[model samples]
Target: MSRIEPPSTDPVNSKPARAATGDGLDPGGRRRARRYDPDRKTRILDAALDVLAEHGAAGTTHRRIAASAGVPLGSITYHFATLIDLRAQAFARYVEQQSAVFEELLEVVRTREEFVEILVDLVHGGPARYRSAVLGFELHLAALRSPDLRVLTQAWTRDSRAALARFTGPDVAARLDALLKGMIMNVLLATDPEPREATRAAIVQTLGPADGSRP
Candidate 1:
């Protein structure tokens, strides 16, 4: 055996590489080695959505998501264990992100027509717009199959219904919620080629005109 070199004279050796503890966070530092970054996770989720939109469900992978997120490939596993986990989280995030738009639209409208106009705009053309309905379908499909996802979906439905009811009153809120969700589902399915305006009109008809009075 060659004479044992007195430990290599590298800076890493001289300084001794610090290992992250049980928390995966450096003891003296604020950042964690294996912990998820909220910003990074959001970016990764968005990138994952883009990848899914471009290549469908099966085309997305850790490397692709990492590339999209502009993070190292190793960080993917650090944040998510399986593709399903990643997909589920991404879908959940998408739903949560979209809800803000719906809430804002509902908030501004004083009447049912105004509400429907906003609804139509949101469905037909809003920020985070998709070229095709596949991504929406994919998320809905995943939620349909996963109880965890369904819980989140149901919460969204309940919250949305409550918001609409706040403006439209309990008497019509349920019906309005059903119409709005149904319209979105129909659009996602692509079975109804009718303009979103038609769906909005249908919802307005269901509302039978806004009372324009706070309950």
Candidate 2:
């Protein structure tokens, strides 16, 4: 029997295979990269929120979010199948956070002064808080295009209006929610140097009764 020579082993390139695990590409030799962790999903989602808020839904791509989160591009899809999936999750988180904050504010809101003050504070933020009011509106506009988003948005509106109705009447509360939404859109687009007074006045007028007393 002819002696079989062991197949000549060619050493991997000294530079190290660019296709290795740390190279960001997935395990199947595909160029798509991925990160491994449940936390990574949340991190990517949060990063996507920041990117989307900064650049709008049109600007929110997997690559952008991965770069922001310092993760691999494929990691986004590992957690979310489509951009809409990510956007839906991000919007859900956004609404949840806003609800929690507003609930806190509502706890102490006895008069229009306090209510408006808290609302403005939450909207405007302190010098140190992340101020992305425009970005928030961008997300809202993006969500309006999707049915899944509409459900969440409507639920959020219904819950909030119901809460407000506890203070104002149901009719007034529903109207107040609509009025506030319009005011928010205006605030996002307005160039006025000081619209707080006008905004506050609008809120007060909506909450106050016809003769400044409950019916």
Candidate 3:
């Protein structure tokens, strides 16, 4: 839109001079300026998580992520060096987000009943927890091949256990983390998930006696 003035309307001496448009844009407006999307990287990361949850790391590609995020393929390369890097970062973000959700879900626990119910909800949290659970498993599978991803999973495990330790003691929290992983993976594969009562029993057993000692 930055226009250049003509040479005084172009008289005999000027001989119909054209406008001086040296601002890297044509006067005819054929081309557009580069878009300013400050949140482009964030959108790409979210789209990466979506792709990972749906397709696992094996199916994730720059082209797929580009299409999902509504960005150019080159944009994915510009932001992320490789699909592996993207997957690891995406899982990191998921862990960060799920960590907050875990805290919020536990924030309302006032009794053993409430804590157990919350753990049950976590196992079968419906759509709210489904995507996160998928991403968690995908991260674990990916970590087996990528040491960087393994580091992320290790830290995620530590933090998750720390959060759970607030309710159960550290020993129980550690065991609970393993139990939740197995139970969640099982639930994901089960055509008909076990009833909430069964999940509650498992959680209570994980909690051991009321003294917070390991069962």
The lDDT of each candidate is 0.64, 0.63, 0.75
Q: Which stretches of candidate 3 lie over 4 Å from their true place?
A: 1-32, 212-215
TM-score, prediction 3: 0.81
**Candidate 2: stretches off by over 4 Å:** 1-38, 120-132, 210-215
Q: Sorted by TM-score, highest first, which candidate order results?
A: 3, 2, 1
- lDDT per residue, candidate 3, 1-215, as tens digits? 11111112112322322222443245886644757999999899999988888888889877778789998666677676556556666777777777777878788878777888888888877886888888898888877866556666776787889888888878989999998898898899999988878888998898877864321
Worst lDDT run of 10 residues, candidate 1, spans 1-10
TM-score per candidate: 0.69, 0.73, 0.81
Error at 134, model 2, angstroms: 2.9
Q: The CA-based lDDT of model 3 is what?
A: 0.75
**Predicted model with the maximum TM-score:** 3
The TM-score that candidate 1 achieves is: 0.69
- The number of clashing residue pairs in each candidate reads 0, 0, 0
The residue pairs that clash in candidate 3, if any, are none
Cα lDDT for residue 117, candidate 3: 83
Candidate number of the best lDDT: 3
**Worst lDDT 10-window in candidate 3:** 1-10
Judge candidate 3 at residue 196 and give its lDDT: 79
